[model samples]
Target: MVTRGTEILVIKRNDPAWPGLTFPGGHVEAHESFHDSVVRELKEETGLTIKKPKLVGVKQFYDDDDHRYLVFFYTAHDFSGKLKASNEGQLFWMTKDELQKQKLAYNFDRDLPVYFNDNLSEHILDGKRDELF
Candidate 1:
């Protein structure tokens, strides 16, 4: 997550695999750590450089296509650079209230509370194909 003040950077995806408003992230490439992948994915998707992205949660589920998906949910507070749009779709910053009004991608609604509630720890969320985007 790329954050400034109370707003967060999110991408409106174009990929059918996962389409809609969501945080910028992708598959962790071979030979790259999760931390490095987050930095790279953030740049590729939103043109931002972030550091020390702490692991917030892990979302594991299968999509409508029956493909298993394991997502590493991260939150970054320190970052730099101007935002840019990619093939992923558009990049936008929204406050919590604004975000609450938007149509989120699939089960992201289940992840929101953990992000807003400080007491929540790194969690493993499991679901089935019916819960996908």
Candidate 2:
């Protein structure tokens, strides 16, 4: 997530698999570090260069085919360049309160605590019954 003051950078995802509002991120490429991937994805999707993205937590789940997926969550306060949207979706800024009122992506509501709460570190969805743990 990218933030400035009380506003957060958000993306209304166009991808059919996960369509709704969420933060900017993508898959980690081969031979790339996690931190570097964050920087690259932000630049590619949001037209911003992020610095020192502190890995705050992670969100993990499994697909219908039992393929495990892990989303590394990071929060960055230092960023540069003008904001722009990619094929992923539209980009905009919103406060925590404003975000709560918007249509969030699947399971994103359950994932919010990990980003806002200092005590939480992970959002895990045990695929069986779609329960949060």
Candidate 3:
């Protein structure tokens, strides 16, 4: 998440597999560090160069093939760049209440606590249920 005052950055993804409002991020590239990947992805997807993005939480689930998929979540309060949207989606800044009203990407709503709750560091989704830790 990238924030400026009361608003947080969000993307309306064009990806068919997981389309709708969600934070901007992408897969980690081979040989890249997790921290570096977050910085790179934010730049590529949102045209922002984030500095010192603090890792806040993670989301994990299994794909259709039963392979574990992990999403590393980070929050950045310091960044600089003209806000622009890439092919991934349209970008917007919305407050928490405003964000709650928007259509979120698949399971993203369920994943929000991990981002907003200081005590929660992980969200796990099994095929049958959701778990937080």
Candidate 4:
């Protein structure tokens, strides 16, 4: 998450499966560290070049079919770039209070709050998907 003052940056996804308001990120390429991937993904999805990004946590999700995936959550307290929206979706800033008013994409509700509350630890969890996997 990239925060501008009291608000944080989020993307409105266009793809299925947890599509909606979520962080700007993509799959990490082979041999790429989570740090590099977050920076690259942020640029691709939001056109923002971040600085000194910190890892918030690593969350693992398990679906009903036993399919699993992992997400490396990150936060950037400082950055440099112009805001530009890509093919992914719209980009916007909202305070933590405002977040409670909007409908988030998926596990954002369960995961991101930990970071906002000053917890820097990692986490692993099972996902709750309304649809069949």
Candidate 4 on 1-133: residue-level lDDT in tens? 8998898888888878768888888899999988899899988888789988987667776877888887777889788888899988888898888876788886677776556666445456654442211
Candidate 1 lDDT over 1-133, as tens digits, reads 6678999887888988767788888889999998899999998888888988988766666656767677787899898888898888899999988887888886666777667767664344445233322
Off by over 4 Å in 2: 129-133
Number of clashes found in candidate 1: 0
Best by TM-score: 3
lDDT-based ranking: 3, 2, 4, 1
Clashes of each: 0, 0, 0, 0
Score each candidate by Cα lDDT.
0.78, 0.91, 0.94, 0.78
Better of 3 and 4 by lDDT: 3
Badly placed stretches (over 4 Å) of model 4 are 127-133
Query: What TM-score fits each model?
Result: 0.84, 0.94, 0.97, 0.85
Clashing pairs in 1: none
- lDDT for 92 (candidate 3): 97
TM-score leaderboard ranking = 3, 2, 4, 1
Model 1, which residues run further than 4 Å from truth? 63-68, 122-133
Measured with C-alpha atoms, the lDDT of residue 57 in candidate 1 is 65
Pairs of colliding residues, candidate 3? none
Query: Candidate 3, TM-score vs. the true structure?
Result: 0.97
